[model samples]
Target: MTTEMGNPRSRDIVLIILSNSIQRLTFLPVYHHATVVVMCCLWLQTKQSLFPIALVTNASVHVIMYGYYLLCVMGLLPKWKRLVTDCQIVQFVISFVVSVLMLYYNFTGFGCSGILGRCFNAVFNASLLTLFVNFHSEDYAKKKQG
Candidate 1:
């Protein structure tokens, strides 16, 4: 899934732009805007080393999710829509693990940066995870029953 973009920074920038643009165009929920703002704040802080993990994971998920949308747009609806939701859930779980590790390191070690941002991120991630899980259950449960 690698692109010809030789520079990682360029790829990150493009992904961020595309993600934000898509979010705006789709008029995503308020929580999505909050997540974007929190991420921007985390990125602006120079000391937040863990921000890249969140960025890369989220960007990767967006790539997959949007790719699915593209397929659907071309009248090629894939049967693996559930996989996108699964990937999103996995992304949040990974974020939770990374956030916990960040907290542990902040307390036990020299201290990590963006501790406050991490707290906000944890709350947002939890809420998003709950929403995604509910969507998965309701969507697929009805599919199964009907």
Candidate 2:
């Protein structure tokens, strides 16, 4: 199949369009709501001083990525998909590092909550990183080769 724009309407292209459309219509809004929860939880943690300072620092990275996500969803950035794929690679690296540091800090016999928090952190970051890696390879690597 081929689109009117002369682009091949392959399965990958269809999936990409569907994913972006879903992100624009729903995912981004839900993500913003989740950010509110994160911010509130961070603020509460700040008051308690339970978590290490890295948690606070990591929030800034999330905010930066959220802004980039918003821009991509809004179609304000040209070549936005490529730009976002590149940014996701950076985000994944930073997230993985932060998550590991968080786990390290609490390795000395932390409570169940502490352990679970790090577990969730690792899983979430890893999952997103995998998705982005697959997307990047499918979208760009094949294009370059073919």
Q: Can you write out model 2's per-residue Cα lDDT over 1-146, one digit (the tens) per residue?
A: 12323322133234446777644433433443344345435434444233444344445555565567578668787444566567657766776786676677667655324455455556666766776677788879887898
User: Model 1 segments beyond 4 Å from truth?
Assistant: 1-28
- Model 1 residue 9 CA deviation in Å: 18
Per-candidate clash tally: 0, 0
Model-by-model lDDT, in order? 0.71, 0.54
* Candidate 1 lDDT over residue span 19-98, tens digit each: 67644432234446545665556555645668777778978987897889789879998998999889989998888887
Residue 126, candidate 1: Cα error in Å is: 1.5
Backbone clashes in model 2, listed as residue pairs: none
Which window of 10 residues has the lowest lDDT sum in candidate 2?
1-10
Question: If scored against the real structure, what TM-score would every candidate get?
Answer: 0.74, 0.47
